[model samples]
Target: MDAQQFLEEFGHIANAPGGVGKLRELILSLAFKGELCVPSNEISATLLDDIERQRLEFNGETRKQRLTRQSNTTTNLVGPYEIPKHWSWVSLSTVGHTWGQKKPEDSFVYIDVSSIDNKAGVLRQSPEVISASAAPSRARKVVKKGTLVYSTVRPYLLNIAIIDRDFDLEPIASTAFAIVHPWEGISGRYLYFYLRSPIFVRYVESVQIGMAYPAISDEKFYSGVVPLPPTEEQSRIVAKVDELMALCDKLEAQQQARRKLQNALRQSTLQAVASATSPHELQTTWACLADNFGRLFHEPEDVDDLVAELKNLAVRGLLSEASTTSPDLEAIKIDCAQMRARYIADGLIRRQKLVGMADCEETYPAHWAVTAFDEVAIVIGGVTKGRDLRGKQVMVCPYLSVANVQRGHFKLEGLKSIEIAADELAKYQVHEGDLLITEGGDWDKVGRTALWRGGVTNCLHQNHVFKARVPSKQLLNEWVELVFNSGVGRDYFAGASKQTTNLASINMTQLRSFALPIPPLIEQQRILSVLSELTKHCNEWCRQMERKQAMSTLLAGAVVSSLTGITIEQEEEPMKAPQTELVAPLRLGTTPDIKAQAPLATILARHHGEMSAKDLWQRFGGEIDAFYTQLKTEVAHGWILEPAPAEMREKLADSVSA
Candidate 1:
């Protein structure tokens, strides 16, 4: 199929567990059956017979090269028409004389099996070796200039490299490997891809003896069956696979680049949107952003950035510019100044001994007054006497803690009850429309405030969270809350905070030092109304996004299930592309639950596919039998996941793989 057609048919398949894997398995199945590419007409019975004769004669004389006889490593005869007319299957050992020794003296480059691609037919560099003392002393395996070296330990790594350079240097390689030097007429690259094809790995993994680190010996490596095509056809298939794989790499890189650019564009647009000063400007910004909203904001971070901008815009009075048309802003400022003077004169409040407001050359709207927050609102410390009353279920009284307050409002869930001395209840009780702020914490979290809309009739807050009660007659609670939570409050809080060892706090003086923009009560309410509406919309947007992400996760999992053939129900037809277990011990890959790990195999047999021994080992691999013994002790004392029979004596096989 063409690239476009393949994508359309199996685009859902990711380079994950099930999706593309199913397609990969199918490709192998077809390739082994001689269906992946067209067969050559040159392959015939006479040519195959000649190759067999050479193979029989070589096997008769070569006792040292004889493969270990294994029931599972038996070879099957291939039909004449099943293979191309000119193609022949021969044992891999037929092409090369053994260069079975390793020598370190020569300038031969050393290669490790780990350096090769286990999944592709390409040899990669071996890990860098630093120890000269560790160099091999045996005569180096002399592979011809065009030889192919296969890492037998992990054949799936597909590390096949063509020996192109005429170097007398002998590279040190693993003993568990077979190097092949292709005969004349057969291209090394063609054989490389064929080795990478699923036929090789599947044959190794299927009849592999033992339960852990299953492997195939050299006998099975050479005797394994492969459908070899004519020399020319082999070259064609190799070229095609190489070209397609390269294109896939390019496509992946392009997609990654596009995603990065989209994220950058979203951030830029969000910044512009926040900086808009007027309704018309905001409208234009919004329109531009909306035009590419679908493409620009697919991720959660983008939505979070948008929310922050929304908060900034709300605090800056851009949420409802029309509300500033009224002239009450100046009137309220004058009233607050008078109130501050009155309080200072009457000794009811503190004087302006704290930091003064910074100078801003640009004047605010004519309808708004730039006044100190303390001048317009009363900032009081909450009660701090609930040390011994944690985690206790008490009567449902309205109580706001630092945890109770969220971004814009209070949360009632998991509310802690407190014993507010009956006589002092009236003094500390919180009412509706009170602004709650954190008194101390990280500098950024210090002034984080939210408006309490009176979820309960009589609630109180702890001393850690400050209470800023707006003068109902002058300032609106919502507007004051927004200012304190916005960039304005953030800047003020950051400046006034005193940072100590691991803690930053804003005292009562700092809270009162904030220079707030005091709008008329009505205009403040209007801005708050606009903010509330937009915030609700943003929240709904967040919910939708979360749902979409959840769906994507599920779909990715479903795609995995489709490829692994783990399911018995053949509910769907084929269409695809690309793109564990083991609990032998509590090692790097093992689980920690010893009691659970102890009976994993028996449990696995009973649970079917619900869970596997591999899962148990993964969960409790570290201590193994010790963990089990401890788990059994815990079970005796009443714990979970322990096998029912505490004395069940099932011996564990040494299935651990290094």
Candidate 2:
């Protein structure tokens, strides 16, 4: 329950994902509670008098008007938590003076929420100057040296800092901040630490109004309680905090350097296995990695490099030996021609232009035959929207876009439907065993392939995704997808696709010309079998790493909770929509959302407006992290509010978090 016990476990705690932040919160909490430093015989009462006298002399106001007026304004005021008897509980207004606001009359430097480096609680030091005529309306608050600027909007972001340097021009902050200039005898650094502590932030959360844009008004913020210490003890606590925080900085830097080293080693070792010239060397290199796997692979993300190397080895005819028999290219061409004739006769698909096949540079077993993608498969573009169909009969059908059609899977949730001419559906409707490949997007997303096995019936693809059907039974969709999604296919796409500012796209002609290495049906199945077995081990390794990470995180939380004397509150159950809508203004501790905000709820499973909404009475009372988690999830998926993926949308959430 003290610094000694916490420091003993610092190494283990810092190894966890978010341990350093928890350690910081604990340090601030203890410092404010009089546990971090030895107390002096001097009590805070003497310092309180010094602060009031200085403030009164500066403002020229009497005690009745300045100190006691609304200082205890609440009906029954009580401090949030007990402090040492030597310390006193005082409102922030008693310790700091509020400043006036004014619009910029001339060019000035503006500091907004974006100006803060939240982690360090310091400015980024990049000043942005605003013109007097072009100043934003929100830039109206004044800032001076030694003043603590704490953002009232999204207060949990910890956008709080003390101005320490002079600006050539007047510095104006956005109205979003509550500027607090400390009175004499109060250390601004100590006040800054207490303001960012968990207990203080929790109090802010409980008093803030509204759910969507929750913010603490300047009035409520100034009325919040602060644990005041004697001037001597304040200086001691600040010094100790700085010393311990410097140690934390060292731990954090060492941990990051270790992870960087591990990642680099994994990449080099995997590269050795991937670049092996023969099956013997591949086995030798892989054995070396397997021998040192425990030392190299410590995170679940490391498996990505391992899996990529496996794919490269598989396509090179190194994972499994090539069979004596070769695929019959003539027979495959004949089968494709017969299917094309039948489709032409039935008006199913268009007559694709036969194009010359391009050569692939990589060497492969002579037993494996090479063919262009169009020779064995029918590749076609999907339907384009915005066409005039005013007089035509149309039907709404679920379709796949670049978002739904992922590299090796589909994101079926929140499926969208579009109206298409009923008769035109035949050409666009995708069936089972079709390979869906993205036409264009980012450099990494171009030519990404996924196989469709009928997750949603009558599903069509949009123009951004290409649908390739292998009508011939000789070529399996599974095999084609494997080759198309492997390193070979990705390399071709990266080289051939038209690229601009990290975005790239490929036309049907480019897709049809892709060189595919074809093996006999039996050999294809054998290679897949080998890949399946090896990837299974890799998958299990990744799962083990995740479980280990979870255990480390749990242990760190438990130790922190025990030492800090904090009861980790259970997360609130998700909010449910009422059977009937209510009229506003709403009451405390009741449903807050009407109907339009219900889309936030729809993001969850089978739930409409299901996001957690606290009744006004219990505004974020139990746990601060629960509220922050809700905000983090919302921000990660906020792009979905556009209901369109113009570009990135928490794509990392699926890839890395998984």
Candidate 3:
């Protein structure tokens, strides 16, 4: 699509996922190319000549140099793209100069690349003051007011900012920055935005060398092409960019507010479904959620949450109707006992006193039975390494570690091999349908469970991954897996695991005691079937969200490509929300006293009083929109006390200053 076409259809895709950010890029590209607004009535041919005169005059040099463009040939130009016929292309070297290297003679504000927050194109924190004696070797570049300091190291990070204010001490930037003191015609604000442009960013990504500390060289950096306009046009472009950027910022905020409202609505709807007791109640609540599906599920993460909630419902026996009679615990135990005998006879597992036990109260369906995990399955710890068995016969085989076992499925790639005594291989060898549960890792990942369908022959498991062999006749592997990875199973592990710092672990005994809710054999199949169908729909929902995002990105990219006369391709990478760890991951926090309280209130109550926004976000199981909205309702009702306003301001200020 051409620029005109894009503008005409802007309303169709300007609010898609990551669309506002894309729009900001389009604005920058358009501004640089002089396509954002009408050209000035008058044009100056000596704009470049005047800028050159100012450079030599500022440097106190009589010598003049010719401008050399860094032609990546991005738009078949002498520069990266075709600019307005009146505007000229110039080298970054011709545009500016930097203060020569110097050793500090006194205390100075050390403005390192870390001081800048690339997002805002400003210093994120107060540059620290360093005494002359303590100054680092790299603290040699001088940055006065109006100078643009662009970090040479890791240029893709876009650690480029203008020195807009003076400091208490003389600000000495780290040598990592290529300080650009622009000539008379260049606007520092305009230059700052130029360096932050998507076009510039893509150029940096292509030219930066090295893997660990990828950076652009001074020689290459100086040769970078700048799309220059008349001095009058520069001011015009900057003004327009500022105006559009402010709109983007406003749009971004509105999008956030909209998402929060959607989240609030979705969360409340899902909660209704989860809390429904009777089948009729479940049906009504589920229908309500289904009715608002369009509003509730916008992103892949939203659908993921739906899937997770479905599993939670499945495990709790709330997904389907239960039989009028309670499940026969004795009959299930009898069947398991018969299976256990065969397991013992084969010398695969040892006899245990208890079938299994639940850590929490049993509030399951009347037709469901509960028992300890070990009753129906052979729960055994895997092989431990570093034993002095040199004399003993051993064989090398692929083994599953905690990393290899993810919830629901095994990640078999990069399977590390371990040497085990040939005799002990059978004990550690995981069979088809055996459940592999991680013993410990990051606290949240400590009890991750995945079913092992044999991929590698004679595969064994590491000590940190426990293997459970559940007989097919006694319990289906799928049913057990569903429960173990559900909210109930996760809660039990989080509460029972021994924790230290961010690490957590559950011992073999704890794994054996895990409570597995058992429905009638026929009901198990029925529930799984229903869950499978629901999950398929949720997956389709996510796919549709992804498809929509992909199309939006392409449309945005087409607009940018056409407007700038540059080929800009949009990569459709799956969005991944970070997994958050909480101090109170599995605790049944205190119940909220406020009747107006909902998700956020309940989470804060669970954590005793207050929790970090990050922690609360994960627990709330909703988007930022819902969480903040619910939190506001609680705080507004005087049910929650927030941090002092002054403290918040200081924290925010310090963050920006850093």
TM-score of each: 0.48, 0.83, 0.79
lDDT for 654 (candidate 2): 40
lDDT of 3 by residue, 1-658 (tens): 5556667868755766678877888888889888887887655457766865775566642222232222322333377766778877766876777766679999999999889988898986677899999999999987898899999898878898998898878999998998788888778888888988987888788888999989987767777778877888889889999999999999889889999999988888888888877778989998998888888888889887788889988987777667565656676567767777876787767766763475656488756777787776777878888867788997899999988888887788898998888888778898888889999989768789988777699999888999877654636788989988888888889988999999999998888888778887777877899899999988887877876776566556555555555555434243334432222222223344332224455446646766665565555444444545665665665555643431111123445659
For each candidate, the alpha-carbon lDDT, in order, equals 0.58, 0.77, 0.76
Per residue, candidate 2 scores C-alpha lDDT tens digits across 415-511 of 8898888888888999988899999888878999999989787789999999988876767778888787788888988888998997999889888
Could you give candidate 1's per-residue lDDT for residues 1-658 as a string of tens digits? 3445446545544432243444544444344345556776666344445544655654432455544222222244452124544555554554332444545654546666655655544555444442446555532455556777776664554566766555444555556567666655556776666566555665667655655444567666666655666655666666656665565556566667877998889989988897787889999998999898888877656677777777678767677754535445445546666755675676545565534554433334666677556656666567666545555543435567777776676678888877755545654677777788888775556888888776587888888888776654666776777777776677777767898977788887777767777666667777777777877887787776764554344344333223322211122222221111122222121222322322333233334423433344333332344435544443354323444233323444447432
- What is every candidate's alpha-carbon RMSD to the true fold? 17.2, 12.5, 18.8
Which stretches of candidate 2 lie above 4 Å from their native place?
1-8, 60-69, 73-78, 570-658
Error of 3 at 200 (Å): 2.5
Local error of candidate 1 at residue 551 (angstroms): 4.0
* Residue 118 shift from truth in candidate 2, angstroms: 2.0
How many clashes does each candidate structure show, in the order listed? 44, 7, 12
